[model samples]
Target: MFFAGDIGGTKVNLALCEVHDGRITTQFLRRYSSAQFGSLSDVLVRYVKEIGPLSGKIEGTCFGVPGPVLNGRCHTVNLPWTPDSAEIARDLAQVVEAGPVQLINDLEATAYGIGLLQKSGQGLSILRAATGAIGHRANQALLAPGTGLGEAMLLWDGIRHVISPSEGGHADFGPQDEEQIELLRWLWPRHKHVSWEHVASGPALHRLYRFLKETGRETEPAELAEALAQPGVDASPVIAAMAIRGQYPICVRAFDLWLFFVGAEAGNLALKSLSLGGIFIGGGIIPNVLELFRRPAFFAGLDSKGRMSSVVAGMPVYGIVDPLTALYGAAFSAAHSHGVLHGFR
Candidate 1:
């Protein structure tokens, strides 16, 4: 057996996984509210305790966390606790006998899972097929907008694609139009330095809604306004749910803007990485609003580049509909890294 987790600020996706019938399958899976736990060890202890003796048979475990993982340690912005790989390994190693727990950037885990996902055919839904020359041995890029924007590059090294984590989401926000410029102006006073993540993430959707409502660009719905008024509620999900249901025009507009921002940033990531292999869209946000991602308008700034439009136009685009990708990836990495599993492309 193997253990895996995709730990985010809001929730921790944990699973007891293993290679079964020549494929990785989960024996158990559950999501824990991150705010309820004080640390990762706390969650792990509870997980092992619940699973009982089976936890001792686990071969290894990997955790996918937000932000960069340096020397087996990570400090994330959204979560209250910082996760350390060595510490987690130490705590659970003896009790669960699951070997060392691995920690990796969530994007890296997602990158590792891309191939496994493609193999399964359920994770990636092609939004746009490649129109230009494609390279089988070329690099790829990932753009995920969840609680925050996450980006990564898959570097091809002849035999396998290596995962490289990035904080490019925090890069400066580039406006695409006069309206977007106005939005930037609106955010300038609030954020000292606005980033692509500032306008593209889940929370950013709420901010976009606020920007539109405050600017009088759209009339806020009365029922939606009541929901937003509730304390400590995530307005993003409410906005996304309402917009997807086509129940509120304001929510639709805000979600539309969010898609545009994601598209623009995706284009930027592709250009920076020269990802001729393709671009994979993964995250909590895209799967929920996949219908919006499939629209032509979602690739707006991607091909609007002055001289390199065709180059980008040819790059394939896929949206990961499966939300458990990161968690599965961590499990794969744990088995593969520990040399218990092999033949991973």
Candidate 2:
């Protein structure tokens, strides 16, 4: 059996699985609120205790962490804790006595999971602003927007497949119009380094609401969230209120601006990597509001890649609807890393 984990801004989930025929057969799994615990180790301890005890020869463990991991150490961006994978290994030595642990950026692991997804007869066609292709099992990217933006790419260089983690989302936020430029100016003072995450994530949504208030727009995220809880409150009600009434012009503007930015960024990613494998968008923000993303404006922004427009236009994009995609991805990465999936080399 092998252990796998998906560590995110809000939660940390762990699972043990038996690998069989390129699939993970779960033995046990659990989730813990990251905020509630003081450190990742706390959750790990709880998980191990709850799962009883391992009885067989455990192979190894792998984790998909939201933050960048350098030299086996990483600090969760939204959580107030730091994790050292090596230290976890030392501690686990006393229990499972398993082998060393491996760590991967959550997005890269997700990208690998995308590669493992069964082909839908699409035969690896690229789709912009959507899920990536399969079969090639290489050269894919994963971009997600949640508490912040996370991105990574996987490359199969013939000899071996490698996963590259990136902080590309932290690159400077570019504007596409006069309105966006004004919004940039509005945002510049508060943040010295304004990245795409500043305008696209959930916290960014709240921040956008605050910006709208400053611009004389009155709606709020809390109010909209309350409305969302109601049976009749769909995205249209909130979107219409913000887009047309300008009741929360800044928030509306932010959302519109984000779609454009997301399109351009995703297009650029497709261009740079030639990820004919596809681009998969996995995160809390986009998947929940598929209707908002399906708007023509969003696609237009993605397809507006100057002379390379056709290249991007043909690229397939998918918003991951499987809530457990990242976890599944983590498991897939673990299996592949441990040499269970066979095609890596």
In candidate 2, what are the lDDT values of residues 72-95, reduced to their tens digit? 888667668778888888767655
The CA lDDT at 182 in model 1 is 97
Error of 2 at 290 (Å): 2.6
Query: Residue 242's C-alpha lDDT in candidate 2?
Result: 64
What does the lDDT read for residue 281 in candidate 2?
Answer: 71
lDDT of 1 by residue, 267-297 (tens): 8889998898898888887777887886655
Could you tell me the lDDT of residue 25 within candidate 2? 63
Best by TM-score: 1
Off by over 4 Å in 2: 119-138, 156-161, 217-254
Error of 2 at 152 (Å): 1.5
